[model samples]
Target: MNFAPTPRTTSLRSPEKLRYDKATAYDVLDAAHICHLGYVHDGTPRVLPTAYARIDDRLYFHGSTGSRAFLSARDEGVEVCATVTIEDGIVFARSWFHHSVNYRCVMAHGRARLVQDPDRRLQALAAMIDTLADGRSADSRPPSAKELAQTAVLELALTEVSVKVRRGGPNDDAEDLSLPHWAGHLPLATVAGEPVPDTGIGVRPPPYLP
Candidate 1:
């Protein structure tokens, strides 16, 4: 809840609005199901989009045990930049040049580590379930020994992070204010649909879709 705001130094004129507070950042992290990960591997930059979850002050990621990134993370424990962005709307301005998008994004700097402890791995697995389905995490059965052997879990400590967001109507320059182009923001959002039962499921189930 008390993180410092790192100003956007890319622009001298119109800098981005930022929500760098730690609690706000966590809110955004929890809202997203996936994050784009950036790291250096084999002296080359790598960016991969993958599913993730959060627990306490650490972010959780899972991948194939043999995945190059996963292995690299476990072996070298290199610093990484994990980002999550969700576009909420399209900002239409009077001029075509002022087009912008309303979005929430978080960029974190941390070292990724493999979850070697069995108890911690189980906790990470449960956190992952809770992230996807609130109550289902408790309703689900614990993973068997065989199942545990087949999964890989990683934890990224949240020591340094930045959360930047933009939300509002179109922004146009003074000269383009009078342009006749259509102007305003077209709202965008993720809407949940009705839950569809599995092929073998016979009776109507409770709300399970999101």
Candidate 2:
């Protein structure tokens, strides 16, 4: 199913907000591993940092059936929000308060349900294993029915998602612009570390980090 971003009242920030369309949001979601999932239970708010993967227009997450959050979701089925954020660079200016960071964030709110199909659950599992670590899913043992039963899978249809972005130099106030100071942005990035191998493997990692 094709999904376009429909901004909810809670998800909208400013009128000039960056484009939160399907293509813009999915690009950020597909690149990140950890997502901050927010939901309400018993009139209280909760957020959990978890891993997620997008298969088509849906996002899938795994947890135990015994998990309090999923159990609550099963009963109440309130709106669910998941956000993926990537911090790309640091922004620095002459003024202290003007400092900021370059980032891309996507927040999605939708109906959440536990996916019970064995085949779909299997595919979601494969997605997680393949996404988190390379070559591990096919190399490791498959999931058994008992194991599957012990676990719970939730799917959030990507219907209403919003993306907000902050990039370029810091936002200095008009009065401070002519302070005759070096007001510019500082760059930041994450470099991939060299991969280490187990001695028993008797081989080195390929040119990739994974």
Candidate 3:
């Protein structure tokens, strides 16, 4: 489904880079485990980077129940903005002004609800664990009731969403393009290295680990 454009969802700066494709937005979001959550507390705006999991069209992020952000969303849903970005490369150009980073990103805006349902909360927690490794939720012990009580999960619907991407080399001016300077993009990616097991219990890592 394509997200309908809203005033907040439209990109005013780089309008050409804006996309409404929900599939592309989902891909960008799923590729990164961290999301910058923007919220307001006591009329002061704040942005916090936190781990999040996406299930269908909603996102779930958890934190200590006493956290200011969680507290702000507890009683009544709070307005929020969630963003995920994946850096693909560094764009090298003939001029410094044209240099930029190649990236895929998604921005979501909505009222974040504090999740209270037991089953939904458990599912969100499992999805979050599995994000680290395909079956990590199954390998690890489930959180105890006491532990769950101390945690708060916030849910945000992906209603006002926008995907923006910048790719290829930097946009060099026509005159600068002929200059004697190397212009190309240096590709980047996240690659997992050999797993270093923790102390005690000498068993190989599960196949789920890269």
Give the TM-score of each candidate.
Answer: 0.89, 0.84, 0.97
When 2 and 3 are scored with lDDT, the better candidate is 3
Please report the candidate that would top lDDT against the real structure: 3
What is candidate 1's TM-score against the reference? 0.89
Give the Cα error of residue 20 in candidate 2, in Å. Answer: 2.1
Model 2 bad stretches (over 4 Å)? 1-13, 75-78, 133-136, 197-203, 206-209
Worst 10 residues of 3 by lDDT: 194-203
Please give, for residues 1-210, the per-residue lDDT of candidate 2 as tens digits.
334544462344454656657787888887887898888878898899987888988998888888777887675464778988989888877689878788888888887788878899888888887776655678679888799888888899887877778889878888888887887776667566767668776467643234
lDDT (10s digit) by residue, model 1, range 47-163:
989778888789988777777788776665757789999888999988778899999888877788888999888888887787777766677698888877778888898867777
Model 3 C-alpha lDDT per residue in residues 31-74, reported as the tens digit of each score? 88999999987788999998999999999999999988898887
How should the candidates be ordered by lDDT, best one leading? Answer: 3, 1, 2
lDDT of each: 0.80, 0.78, 0.92
Clashes of 2: 0
